[model samples]
Target: MPANFTIVTLGVADLDRSARFYRDLGWEQRGDQAEGITWFRTSGSWVGLYGYDALAEDAATEPVPADELPTYRGVTLALNLASEAAVDLAFARVQEVGGTIVKPAARTDWGGYSGYFADPDGHLWEIAHNPYWTVVDGRVDIGAT
Candidate 1:
C-alpha cells in the first residue's frame, strides 16, 4: 500500500458552523465545492466536511450523539510545527477561532512541545513541535542524521 493520505472527511453536526470555523482559520473552500459537502485544500491533502448523520448513514452505521463520544477517540489529527513558538502561535489561532483547548502547549517528556484542541464537532487536533523531526511544506518526517 502507498504511504500517502488523499483526504480526511470529518462528519460535523452543523455544516455551517464547522465550515465557518475552518474559514476562520485562514482556509478557503475549494473552487468546485458542491452542495451538502464542503471541501478545503490543505498543503498535501483535502479536508471535507459533511453532515454527521448523513455521513453515518452513508457508512451504514447509526450516528452517535456528540456528547457521548469517548473522551479519547482512537485517532487524532496532528499539525506539526518547526518550533515551539510556532506551536504556541498555532494554538493561539485555534483559541481565537473558538476551538476548545483540551490542554495548553507544554514541554513533553520526550523533549517536545505539544497541546490538544477540539473542533466544533469534537475532532481532536494536536499541535506540536518535535525538535527531532523535520517539518517542511506542511509535511512532517524524520531526517537521517
Candidate 2:
C-alpha cells in the first residue's frame, strides 16, 4: 500500500484564533480561505483548522461543547523534529507563541527526546526528536528501521 498523508484537519473552537496561532508559527495559507475554515501549507501535508461546529456537521457528528472544557482524550498531534536542538527550538517557539508547555523537553526512557504543549484549544501537541528516525524533505519516518 502507498504510504501518504495528505491533510490533517484540527477541530478548533474558534477557527480564527486557531488559524492565527498556526500563522504565528510561520505556516503559510494556501488557496482561498473562508470564515469558518482556514487551510495552510506545511512542509509536507496540509494543516487545516475549521470551526468545531462546521467540522462536526461535515462529519455528521455532534460538536463538542465549546464551553464544556474538553480533555485531551488521548489525542495528540506530533511534530517530529530533525534533532535534539531542533526539538528545543520548536518547543521554545511554542512557548514564545503563547502555547502552554505540558511537558519539558528531555531524554525519554524510550530512547527519544520529546515534550508536549497545549494549543489555544487545549489540544495536545507532542514535539519529539527520535534519534532512530530520519526525515526526508520534512517528513519524518517514525518507524525507521
Candidate 3:
C-alpha cells in the first residue's frame, strides 16, 4: 500500500480555544465543526484539533496524565515560507495574531532563517524560510540538500 498523509490532528484541552488560536493565526476553518473538534486547511494536509479526552476516548485509550499538559516535548509545528522576507512577514503576522515569540527570527547555521513561537495553549510552532527549499502551488517540496 502506498503511504499518504491526509490530516494532522492535535489533541487540545479545549477545542474552541485551539480553534480560536488557529483563527488568530489566520487559518480558516473548513466544513462542519463538531462540539469538540475543529478543522483547518493547510498547504498539503488538513489540520485538526479535538478535545484531549475526546480524542483519547475515540482512540480507545486513557487520557494522558494531566501533568503532561500541552504534551509538546520535542515536537514543533513548522511552517515554511517562500522567502527570507516572507519569514519576517510571517513572524510579524504570528505575533499580531496572539502568538508569543519563543525565539526571534534569525539566520541559522544550516543556511535558513527561522524562529519559534507558542500558541495560546502553549503549543510550540516554528516559522521558517529555508533558502534551499521551495513551495509550489502551496505545497512544500523540500529541496534543502
Q: Pick the candidate with the highest lDDT.
A: 1
Deviation from native of the Cα of residue 85 in model 3, angstroms: 1.7
Model 3 per-residue lDDT tens digits across residues 1-145: 7678888777777677778878877887986666557789997788888777877888999975655665366789888888889889988887888878999899999999999998766678888888887877667888556
TM-score of 3: 0.85
Best by TM-score: 1
lDDT of model 3 at residue 6?
83
Candidate 1: where is the Cα deviation over 4 Å?
31-34
For candidate 3, the lDDT comes to: 0.81
| Sort by lDDT, top down from the best | 1, 2, 3
> Which residue runs of candidate 3 sit more than 4 Å off their true CA positions?
65-67, 70-72, 143-145
Clashing pairs in 3: none
Each model's TM-score, in the order given?
0.92, 0.88, 0.85
lDDT of 1 at 68: 95
lDDT of each: 0.90, 0.83, 0.81
> How accurate locally is residue 105 in candidate 3, as Cα lDDT from 0 to 100?
94
lDDT for residue 104 in candidate 3, whole number 0-100: 89
Q: Write the per-residue lDDT of candidate 2 for residues 49-103, one digit (tens) a residue.
A: 8877888899999876877855566788888888999899998888888888999
Which is superior by lDDT, 2 or 3? 2
> What ranges in model 2 sit over 4 Å off?
1-3, 142-145
List, residue by residue over 8-38, the lDDT tens digit for candidate 1. 9999989889999999988868744358889
